[model samples]
Target: MNIVDIIIKKKNKQELSYDELSFAFNSYLKKNIPDYQMSALLMAITINGMTMKETINLTDVFIKSGEVYKFNKKVCDKHSTGGIGDTVTFIIAPIVAALKIPMAKMSGRGLGYTGGTIDKLESIPGYKVELSKEEFYNQFNKIGLVISSQTDKLVPLDKVIYSLRDITGTTESLPLIASSIMSKKIAAGATYIVIDIKYGTGAFIKTKEEANEFSEMLNKIANHFKRKIRTIITPMDNPLSSCIGNALEVIEAMEVLKGKKSPLKEVSLEVAAHIISMAKDISVKEAKELCEEVLNKKEAYKMFEKWIITQGGDLSKIKVSDKIITLKSSVSGTISSINALNCGKLAVKLGAGRLTKESQIDYGVGIKLLKREGSKVKKGDVLAELYVNDLDIKLTDEDLKLFTIK
Candidate 1:
């Protein structure tokens, strides 16, 4: 019944019962248990890990801590574990929506190198990220898609626990991380969920093996809630899209919706096809062709424009900063690699991203890649450009080393 008992049990590597896990999380939510006690329990969990049952129990309690949205129509949603330049949601949601699939999503802001879906959407002028429940449902009913900010009343305990983990150096615990993400998705009341799990330098999971493990864990947890989930593991050694900033990322997504041929377009279509396949129960090939059809015919673009206007976003005024610096190739050769993690860190340094939740982001500032992998460049050829509010943005030797030419 007491937090101390649970903490001590976990500290001794003993498996806590469902009631024990429930009592700990509920007590923490009710403020009956101090943060110090929770911190101790988290550390114990980090060191001694949790069984699948324990992890699911923790996730259940977290979901029960807040409101679970129920939609009148069949609900489908997509989530990404996050990666540099991840704007796939903008594409997939619209693609599925254009297919008459109900897509209701809740997203968050960027904290480090990973781009937040809400941040990219907010870069559009007049876009309303905070929509009331009625407005959200209305948008879904009207256009079959709606994206909004995560409500505090939904899985609030994840917020508190995540903040604590941020400072306690326990953020790397797989069980904790999986539970935090799955809890929100489960609470969102989506019957079908598509998740993008990225791993590499710029992703949370640094290896494909780790990504697979996390994906399995995530699916198991989702199954506990009886939600059908699909997970994709992608590489993040370089930015997922061609752009790595707020407004710039939106511009890239707009290009994709307009049927422009780019890397972003390619990856987004793949992810969207998966969503379409699940939502419509069609073959992957059929889903892919349909997704491309929507893009080529500009149906998804229309949906995107309508969604933006419905949410109060202005498409016309979205612009990147005028302060741009083009970095040229010092030597001519093929670009063998680009370090996404370094580029993301540089973006954060240049005010394109946030160091913490409280940090303000300059939506106008970001990096754009002019050339990608296997591209041969001549000396003095433009490789990338930097957009910044401050003209004094400095690039370090390490930053310059991010691009490797062979």
Candidate 2:
């Protein structure tokens, strides 16, 4: 079968036969099918779109290209499309794990504005993010929560296809996104799955309506496949929590798991309670009580620390710098708005995040706002602090334009 014919066929809005799919996948894997042809095929798929059957079949094709984990033990996991300060995974997994619910989770790195799970975990000193299949499985069995980078062997084909999608501008295709997410979760041996679909200025979907649409699509697909999945649509109009960036997020998570209360703690606790409730087959109220117990007993944080240690991460020496470069209000008044998008941009500029994949992140560098939401301020009041290596880090006057006081 000619791969070019299949590409053109897809481009023409034709549904490919199973044999054609097999041939194309084999050709791609064998390096016989070039990227340009794949790009054409992806663009076609993006526009014409795939039927649910086609999407699932594409998933099946990718699944066959690598190994899938089998826990035999009951396992559960969750994922977010990503949002500012969305550290739910770091909080929820441990809660469920403390409840003795098995959590087999894999995370990724930051691509753009959204933070990466692996990046947050790496903030802990000596924590290992890369785990082999045996290591991941063993860690899951031992700790009940194993968080690591997606294994190269687990859904290798998805990686290749995903890269193609990224460059081809086909990353936002709903079916492709759903298949990519669900396939990875399904492969990770999660008998139960909870999806946090976020939308707002900080979310990729950019609107609650769009985020909910993706949530529904994922839920429907998971149900049709008889894979139990719970999807929750959340708003990211503001930072999911106050903290944004890797190490600071870890620090913030430490506080949440330690039973501290903040906007972040509130959101994370709510999510953790819900997911833990569902994963353990308990009522929401009971799930909440359990999370409280985990936090009160400090088991959640301890489990987190344990997970870090198990992953070869050192916890003791890991610290976000206490020495901060505070940006004070030159003139204080009624604070009108904190533009999350621009603050995120400024944070990235100040080394709190990455502009590209290869960019180095300062684990110690981050942004900490002295104020959040509504606040009355005065001249000389600190608005935020830029935690960085540069002694003379400047908060550009342009960033000040985004922070307004009326």
Candidate 3:
């Protein structure tokens, strides 16, 4: 019953019952269990891992810790497990909505190297990231799409545990990660969910094997709850888009919505197609064709515009820093690679992302790729441009190492 026994039991690699899991978690939420005690249990769970039953129990505890939203209409939702230049939400939501599917998403903010959907949306002036429940419901009912920040009332337990996990180096635990993500999605009440699992240098899941394992775990949990779920594993060795900052990413998303063809658009369509298939009871191929039709006909873009206006986002006010530092090749060759992890780090250094929770984001600053992998480059050919407002932030040779040519 006590937290010490729970910590010891988990540290011994024993399975915890639902009551034990709930007791420890709820005690922590009530401040009866100190962080150090919780930290011990978390580390134990991370290293020893949790059984499926235990993980499901923990996820249920997380869900019960806060309010669970319900919608009168069936809605589809999408989530990505952190990545560089992963702006699929912007394009995917509108595409689904354009096809008359409802999508209500609760997005997060940038913490380390990855960009957040809410942060990108906020770059558009007057865009409201926090909405009351009534406002969120109204927007979903009106436009069939709404993306906003998670309210404090939803999954508050995950917030506490996630912050602890971040500092304790326990974030990579499969059970913790699955519970944290699934808790939010379940609480948000999406009837159908598509989780885009990214794996590579820029993503949390570093290898394809791990990505597959994680996806299986997700599907297992989804099945337990009887939720319709699809998990798509994608590579994140390079930026998903040519742009890697808040406002710049928003601009790139708009371009994709306007019928621009690129890898970003392809990924968006793939994810949207899955959601559409689930929501409309059609095949993914048919959903993809529908997505292409709406995107090509500018219906998705129009929906995007309408969603923005409904949420008070001003596209005209979206701007990137004009202070550009273009990185060019000193030798001619084909671009063998662009390190996504390094690109994300450089963007964070340029104030495009937050190092800490309290750190302010420089919405106008980011990186724009002029040339991608496999592109031919001559000496002095531009490889990328650093859009920055701070003149003091100078480019370094380390920054140049982001691109490899041979």
Give the higher-TM-score candidate: 2 or 3: 3
lDDT of each residue in 19-79, candidate 3, tens digit only:
9999999898888988899999999998999988998989999999998889998989899
lDDT of 1 by residue, 113-194 (tens): 6777888888999999987767877888887788998677888888788767655667667788888888877787788888
Using TM-score as the yardstick, the better of models 1 and 3 is 3
Whole-model Cα lDDT per candidate?
0.84, 0.76, 0.89
TM-score of each: 0.92, 0.87, 0.94
- Which pairs of residues have clashing backbones in candidate 2? 125-314, 126-312, 126-313, 126-314, 127-313, 128-311
What is candidate 1's TM-score against the reference? 0.92
Per lDDT, the best of the predicted structures is 3
Give candidate 3's root-mean-square deviation (CA, Å). Answer: 2.0
Candidate 3 — which pairs collide? Answer: none
Q: By the lDDT metric, which is better: model 1 or model 2? A: 1
lDDT tens digits by residue: candidate 2, 331-405: 878777766666667667767667643577777777777777678899999887777777676666786544578
